[model samples]
Structures are given as C-alpha cells and as structure tokens.
Target: MHDSHSERMSGSETRAASGLALVFAFRMLGMFMVLPVLATYGQDLAGATPALIGLAIGAYGLTQAVLQIPFGIISDRIGRLPVIYIGLLIFAAGAALAANADSIWGVIAGRVLQGAGAISAAVMALLSDLTREQHRTKAMAMIGMSIGVSFAVAMVVGPLLTRAFGLSGLFWATAIMALLGIVIVAAMVPRASHPLQHRESGVARQALLPTLKHPDLLRLDFGILALHAILMASFVALPLALVEKAGLPKEEHWWVYLTALLVGFFGMVPFIIYGEKKRQMKKVLVGAVAVLFLCELFFWQFGNSLRALVFGTILFFTAFNLLEASLPSLISKVAPAGGKGTAMGVYSTSQFLGAALGGILGGWLYQHGGLSTVFVGCAVVCAIWLAIAVTMREPPYVTSLRLPLSAAAVADTGLVTRMLAMPGVADAVVVAEEAAIYIKVDSEKLDRTSLESLIESAPERAEA
Candidate 1:
C-alpha cells in the first residue's frame, strides 16, 4: 500500500506541478483581489453607478465563459505554451487598461478584455501532458488548493490595497502579477514531452452534446451557475451593507473579511471530512445550500448591526467554502469514464456565466429595491439549487484511474470482462489506441496488488 517507488512524484513532475500551481495562483489572486473592495471604492470613478460597478465586477466572467473553451480548443491546434503566453499578455493589457481608466465603463471594458484571455482549460491540458496518468490527480489537486488559497488571500488583501492606494492602484498591482505569471510560465514551467489529447483531461468536441445532455451533469452545472450568481450578487451589496448598515469604517473592512474567511475555511473542514468519510455527500451538499439560504435571510432581516453582519458573513462563507469544494468533486464523481474533461468544461462555463449574471442582477436589484432585495434574490437562487440538489441521485464514491495496458491485453476479448469482475472496479474502458485502460474504482474496496498482477500477466498470456 505504501510503495514509495510507485507513489513518489519525479523531480520534473514536482517542478511542473508547483510551477503551474503558482501560475494559477497568480492569475486567480489578481481576479479575486477586486471582489472585496470594488463596490465600495468604485464609486470614485467617473460615471460610476451601482449597476455599472457591478458590471465591472462581473465583466470578466462574460468573456471568460465565452472564450475558455475556445482558447483550449485553439491550444490543441497551436500549442499549450503559446496559448498561455498569449493569454497572459492579454490579461496584462486588460489590467493596464483598467488601471488607467477613470470611468466605470472603462473598467468594465477592461474586465471584459481580461476575461478574453481565458486559459484555464489550456493550463489543465498542459498539466495533464506533463504528469503521468497515476500522478495527474494529485497534480490537479495541487492546483485546486492553490486556487482556494488565492481566493482567501484576495478577500483579506483586496480591502487593504484599496484603502491604501485606491482602485487604480489595485489594478496596477494585478497587472504586475499577471506579468509576473508570464515570467513564471516561461522560466519555471517545463514543456510537455508528448502532448497527447487525453479524453480524461481535455474536452472532446464530439462528446460535448452527450455531456451537456447528462441529467446529473446538467444539474451540477446549474448548481455552479446558481452558486456563483449567489456569490456575485451577495457581494454587490455586502460591502455597502457593512459600511452603511453596520457602521463599520471602510478601512477596517479587511478585518471582517479575514475573520469571516478564517471561520469559513476552518469551520467547513469537519463537515467536508464527515461528508467524504461517511459517504454522505448529497446530504452535506443540501445542508450547505440550506445554510446559505438562511444566511442570506439573516442578512436581509438582521444585518444592520456589525456583530450580526459579521455573523452572517461567517455563516455564508462557511456554506460557500463547503459547496465550492464539494461541487467539483461531485462533477468528477458524476461524470462518466473518459468524459470527465468534457463535463468539467461545461461546469466551468456555467460557473463564469453565473458570475456574470449575479453581478448584473445584483446591481439591478440594489438600484431598484435596495440591499434587502439583493439578499432576497440570492435566497431565491439558493432555493432553486436546493430543489435541484434534492432530486439528484446519490453519487457513487469512486475515483478514476488510468492504467497502462500492453498491446496483448488490449487484444484479449476477455480483458474487459476480467477487469470488471474485480472487486471495487465499478467501470472500465479499454482505449487501445492509447494502450491504456481507464477505470472507476471504489478505493475502499480496491485490491491494488491483484489489479497490477492481472495486467502483468497479460503479455505472458498473449505469448502463450
């Protein structure tokens, strides 16, 4: 079970994973760093309005959602590194444009431009190229953890940056970070030796329709859209609520964010453990969404006091962090073997679209009906997601693994039958062209020794 040789990542794998993680962190940090302070400080811009400000906050999502898939598709045509380099340059340009803009619409344009540089799928593709099939999951996890950290850091740091240097300064700082990301990519990250199109890793254009039509996958996609919409909408009014309703000074806002995020981060750990270990994912997911609903209601009704606002913020984030982590894992669990990448692509698009919708919708509600309406809107969104979650079938607790298969094993008509007969092997597919077998297995019941022995015996059987 603890074979070091089989488990340990090679030196190059470690470097590649770490470098790409840094690149991801840098980009996400820049994107998230605006969320906390934008609604409050963006008023200083010429032509700034609540609606336009909200548009500015969410503009990136629109272009990002539109272009993320296309960028990835083009990466396959040209190359991963070139697409990444071009995306980073575009991101920097957008940041620079925003930094110089004195008007809200200018910032919105800049944000849209920033979104145009979408590179997430390409990055994932490159990561898949760099890592062996056995180590790819761990590498992907590394990137996911980096993103979570970046979000937390941004929440705390964004307010402080705005307080000290104003909105323009923050944009300037993001530009610098984007430029720095380019340097990291060029200097630190290594190129993939064999950039093959992996069905488990890269979206297969032909698989798009089926992935989209998958009922469970569609529900999950809607969940992300609603979740991000709730997030963006809530933030549209939350800063103003903290300042005007709670009487918290603008400069000290970061303290509240830091405290709430810390609570959210640490508080959700137990629930996540319970959910995964107990195999109660659906229950946990529904419970988290319910908590979100209650939190929004609390804000709507009792958010005037500083303590109440802080409490509500903490609760909201606790649920948010839980859902944020759970949704992707669920997507992976629900996706069919050899179709995970396509499922994820759709999920990512829904997430960005939700952000865009939330921003625009939050702004409209705030302008027309005030802060309370924003909360109510988010609550309504949560209710819809809750309904969807309740109807979803309990997801199987399985992990996907890709094992190399010799040509002999692939030629065996009994290969699939034998693999499927193994305990814990829920699903298996033989991809002869890649000389590999992709399997979904329940780790708790899997017998690794037996599985490896079966594969090792294949070549011998062929010779016989």
Candidate 2:
C-alpha cells in the first residue's frame, strides 16, 4: 500500500524551516513578553480605566485574529516578503506608539496596531512553501517549539523587563527587536516560492470553509480556542487570588510564573514522548484535559496557602503544555493536504479569538463575582472541551515508501490514481526526484501478503 510522510528531508528543507521558525520566535517573543506584567503596571497611568486596561491587554489578539487569514491570502498573491515586511512595519509602529505613550488609551491604540501586523498565517504559509510534504510536520513542529519557547521566556522575563526599563522601555526594545527581524528576512533569509505554485499565486481569498467542515480539525480548533481562553482568564483571576488569599506581593508574582513554567516543562516531556511513540495520542490528550479539569477544581477550593496555589499552578501548566503540543500535531496529521494552509489559518484565528474573548470576559466575570466564580468558569470550559475531545476518532497511521525514479516514473499520470485505489491507503503524496511516497493508511487492515505478491511479480512496482 502507498503511504505519506516517508521522505527524509533535504538540506534545503532543514535550513528554510529553521529560518522561518526563528522569525516567528522573535515576533512572538515581543508580543508575549509584555503580558505577565501589563495589568499590574497599567494601574497608575493616565486614562487607565479598568475596561480600557483590558483592551490594552487583549487588543493584539483581536487584531491578529481578524487579520491572520487576510494577510495569508495577501502573501499568496503579492509574495511572502512584501506582506511580512508590511506586517513587521506595522508591528514596529505599534511598538513605537506604545513606547511613547503616557496614557492607557495610547497603549491600547498601540496594541491595536501591533495586533494589526497579523503575519502568523503568512509565515506559516511560507514555511509550507519551503518544505516538501514529507518534511512538513517537522517544519511545523519547529514553529510550534518557537511559540512555546517564546511563551516560556516571556513569562519569566516580563517582570524583569518591567523592573529594569518599565513598560515603555520594553516597548522600545521590542520595536528594535522587530526591526532586526525585518533585516533578517530582507537580507539573511532566502526567498522561497510556494511549493505548489512555485510561481505567483497573488493574494486570492483562501477557501476557508473546507477546513471549518473537517470534523477532526474542528475538534482540534475547539481545543485551541478553549485552551487560550482558559489561559487568559486564569491570569485575570490568579493575580488577585495571590494577593488577597495567598498574601503574595505584586513584584514576587514572577516567582509563581517561573516555577510553573519550569515544572510544566519537565512534567510534560514524558507524556509527550510517550503519546507520540506509543501512538496513544487520544488517551494522552484526554488525560491532559482531565488533569486540567481537576486543576480548575483545585483552584476553586484552595488558594489559601502559597504551597497549594503553587502546586495547582504547576499542575495547570503541565496540562496546558500537553494540549498545546498535541492539538496542532494532530491537526497537521489530519488536515487535507491541498488546503493545510487554509486549515491552519482558521485554526490560528480561532485560537487568537479565544485569547481575546478570555481577556474581555474574564474581566467582567472577575468584576461581578469573586475568585470562586472565575475558577468555576474555567472548570466549565475544560468540561466542554473534554466532552468534545471524547468524540475525536483515532488518527490513521502513516507509512513511508522509497523507490528509484526513472523518466517513465515522471511521466506516469495514472500512478497516483493506482496508488489511491490500493486497499488501506488513505492518502498519498509522491516526489519524483526523491522517488518516495508518503502515505496515511489503516495499519490494521494493511494487506501485506498482496503487497509482497505484487512487488514480487512486478519488481518495478516494489514498495520501500
């Protein structure tokens, strides 16, 4: 049977994938690095109304969610570089605007502009352009790590940055960082054509509905949306809980962040390794959600002691890390091949919208009710996600095949059709020069005897 995900990546694939990964890391670092301290520091600024403060915190997500797909389509039409450049330029302006602001409204305006950059979808599309089908998962995983690292760093450094240069100084520093990113893309990064188009596809509306309709992809998207909403809402309630219940000082809040991040990093590794290697992804993902549900339950009951809150925080992040890693990997595996970019675009948008919604709703919830209510709200969210996750089907197993190519192989238009007709073969992608096929298949139903007989009789049709 034919299979997908078999080809070993070429040197160029590694380089381009790594470069795009770094670019996204730099961009996200600037955004996430300010989040941990935004609420505490914004209190004394002019025009610092509570509602406006929430907007400042969430404005970027609103913009990023709204613009991500449009910017992606723009990149498809105009070229990746131009859209990336424009996005960075807008991002820089937002940073500069924040740096010079004396009022909370000014910061809100700056954040809105920063969100306007909306280059995530474009950057992902560009990575797809650079890597072949077989290596795309590895390429996407690199970007995921970049995002994870950025979040981890920001959680730790957000407080330290504010302590040293204040929020305005952080803004200026981030602007400079973004400017450097622009230079890297403009000079150091090599231009790549879309692998499918390898020519101009000038910005056209990416068909969005197909991704929205895929049941498996839809489940993962819901996971992402709920996951981020919980994260944002957690912060809204957590700081006050630390102050009123746990008696922790504001400046010392970073200690909580640092410990949770470290613990979560170490704690999540084993499950992540086990799930991927053992092919127990569905179990691990559901178990993680169950843990999240328990953590929220714990949060509602225990904020009186620093130790308990610290433990609860650690547990929460551990589950968060697992879901964050697993959801997208599964999405990549299940997404339709030709429209993976569009699927990802919708996925990113939903994720950001959740973040924005979390911030806004969390504020209202906190203002109206106390800590218990906020936590109960998060528990409700995880319950919803867990119910959705219960419905997800087991993913198909992928197999790799290698063959030597000839001129005849290049010209065989019917080869793909023949491969698709094979029993147990769910999906197939082939590379001519590489002479390899990556396939998704039903492993339990694979007809190994028939496959061997065919290869024995027709050696040229041999499987790798």
Candidate 3:
C-alpha cells in the first residue's frame, strides 16, 4: 500500500514558513506587549476608567474580528500579497496613532485602527499558496508556535519596555515592528508563480454556511471563543491583583510572568505528547478545559495570596498553551475537506470576538463588582464550555490532499465518484472553477500508487 505521508520540507519551504512565522510573531508581539501593562498605564491617561481600559486593551479584537473574513475573501480576489501589504500599512498607521495618543479614548481609537488591519487570514492564505499541501500543516503550526512564543516574550518584556520608554514608546516600537514586517513581506517571502485557488487555504463564500453549521466545528469554535474571552476578562483584573493584592511592584511583574509562562510551557509538554501519541485528544481537551475552570475558581478563592496567585497563574498558562496549540489542529482535522479555509476564517473570527467581549465584560465586572466577579464570570464561561466539550466526538486521524486537474476532468463526475470510492478516501470535493480536486484520507491506509496512476492516465484538457 502507498502511504499518503508528508516528507520533510525543502529549504525553500523552511525559509517561507520561518519568514512568515516571524512576520506573525512581530505583529502578535506588538499586540500582546500591551496586554500586561495596559491596565496600569491607562489609569494615567485622561478619561481613564476600568471599563474604558478594558475596551482599549481589547478594542483591536473588535475590528480584527469584523475584518478577518473579509480580508481573506479580498485576498482571494485580488491576490494575497497586496492584501498583506495594505494590512501592514494599516497596522503601522495604527501603531503610530497609538504612540502619539494622549488620552484613553485616543488609545482606544488607535487600538481599533490596529485591529482594522485584519491580515491573519490573508497571511495564512499566502502560506498555503507558498507551500505544498503535505507541508501546509507544518507551516500553520510554525505560525501557531510563533504566536505562543510572542505571548511569552511580550509578557516578560512589556514591563521592561514600559519602564524604559513608557507606554507611548511601546507603541512606537510596535510601529517599527510593523514597518519591519512590511520589509520582510516584500523581500524575504517568496512570491507565488500563479494565482492558485487553494480550497484548503482561503475562504469560499459558498462554504461558509455549511462550515458554520457543522456541529463538531461549532463546538471547537465556541471552545476558542470562551477560552479567549476568559483570557481577556482575566487580564482585566490580573495585573491589579498582582500590584494591589500581592504587593508586587510594577517593575518586578515580569518575574512572575516569566516564571509562570516557563512552568506552563513545561507543564503542557506531557499532555501534548500523551494526546498525540496515545490518541487521547478528546480526553486531554476536556481535562484542559476543566483545569481552566479550576484556575479561575482558584483566582476567586485565593485572590489575595501571592503563593496562590503563582500557582493559579501557572495552571492558567498551562491550560492556555495547550488549548492554543490544540484547537487549530482539531479544526484542521474536523473541518470538511476543501472547506478548511472557510472553517479557519470562522474560527479566527470567533477567537477575536471572544477577546473583544472578554474585555468589555471583564471591565464591566471589575468596575461594578470586583476581581472576584471577573473570576466568577470567567469560571462560568469555562464551565459552560466544558459542558459543551464533553459531548464532542474525538477527531479522526486524517489529512487533506489537493490534486491538480485538467479542464476536462473538472467536468467529469465519474472521476470524483472513482476518487471517493477508493479505500481510505474519506471525503472528496471537485471544485470545477478551481480546476482541482480536494480530498481527505487516512494517511496510513491510502493507496497512493493507484491514485497517482489514475491521475497520470487522465488526459489533459485545454484551458479556455
């Protein structure tokens, strides 16, 4: 039997994946760097309030959520690089605006503008264009890892940057980062030779409704939404807890974050290894959610103690890192073949929307009720998510395949039927417009020789 397996990436693939991952890291660092210190810094700005501070912290998410899908769609129409170019410019402008802002509302406006860039989907689409189907998952994972690393770095560095240059200076640094991203996009990233319709890459309008209605996908989407919501909401009060309740000075906050993040990263490894090696993803996922719930509860019960806060922070980051890494993998497995792009677009939107809601909700709870209320709200959300997660089916082991087709084959219904009938082929979609076929198959069982022979024998049809 011919196994449908991926090979080690080529040098070009490594370069492309790494460069783009760095691009994502720079952008994410800019956003995350503000998260740890924004609450404290906002207090000094004119018209500052707890609610508005939360809004400012999360305002970018609102614009990002609203624009991510549209940006992906636009990339499909106009090409990926152009969309990325525009987005980087917008992000740079937002960073500059934030850097110059003197009031809380001004910062909020800047954050909103920052969110408006909404290039994540476009960036992923470009990655798909640049890489082979077999290597795409690795590319995606690189980007995911970059985001996680950026978060850790940002948590540790945000305080130091604020101490050195102040909040406005931090924004200036982000603007510089954005400019650097633009340069990387232009020079380092490879260009696609032709405009390819990547069913696994960019959003398809027709696929949106079906993708959204998928029960399993919906569960994952809601999981990410609740996860990020709790994250944003918790941060609204966490810094305050550190400063006021734990008596940690602002400058020393990095020590706590560095310690917690290191512990969390180490703690997440075993679960990841066990889940992947033993095929216990569902069990691991449920456990992570439950741990997240308990982390919040711990925050509520031990909000005033340094040791408890340290322990809770460690647990919180462990769960966060695990979920962050796992959710995209699950989505890729669970999403219908050929609709991966649309499914991911929706997933990204949900993630950002949750951040926005978390900020708004967390701020409100903190303003009216207190940190305890924020923790309680986060716990409630996690509990509901955990309930939903319990009913989810374990995702099957599978991978996507994109095969080029001639124009004549595009019209051949029999070709699709034959492909679908092949053993280990779980789903097959023939997109005539794209002149390609997309398939999902059990990699271990797939008969690649038969499939390749069939494709080799098919006559090429002339394009119109």
Give per-residue lDDT, candidate 3, residue 381. 99
- For all predicted structures, in order, the TM-scores are 0.96, 0.85, 0.95
Per-residue lDDT for 172-192 in model 3, tens only? 999999899989888888888
lDDT of 1: 0.90
Please provide, for model 1 over 1-464, each residue's C-alpha lDDT reduced to its tens digit, 9 standing for 90 to 100.
34433788888888889988998998888888889888999888999988888898889999999999999899989999999989988998998999999999889998999888899999999999898777988999999999999999999989998888999899998899888989988888887876777878778876799898999999999999999999988999999999999888878899998999999999999999999999999999999999999999999999999999999999999999999999999999988777888899999999999999999999889988999999999999999999999999989899998887778998876777888999998888887777888788899999999998988887787778
Which ranking of candidates, highest TM-score first? 1, 3, 2
Point to the candidate with the largest TM-score.
1
- As a TM-score, model 2 comes out at 0.85
In model 2, what are the clashing residue pairs, if there are any?
3-438, 3-439, 4-438, 4-439, 5-438, 77-202, 77-203
- 1-464 in candidate 2: lDDT tens per residue? 24334467766677777777777887887887767777677776897754566567777889999998788777767878888889999999999999899999888889889989988877776776777654766787788898999889888787788878888988987788788878877665666744344111112233356677789999989999999888877777776677778898767888898999899999999998998788888999999999999998898988677888899999999999989888877765676533445566678888988888777666667667867877888899999999999999876554433333354544555565665777976766555544433445555666756644433433354322
Span of ten consecutive residues with least summed lDDT in model 2: 198-207
Relative to the true structure, candidate 1 reaches a TM of: 0.96
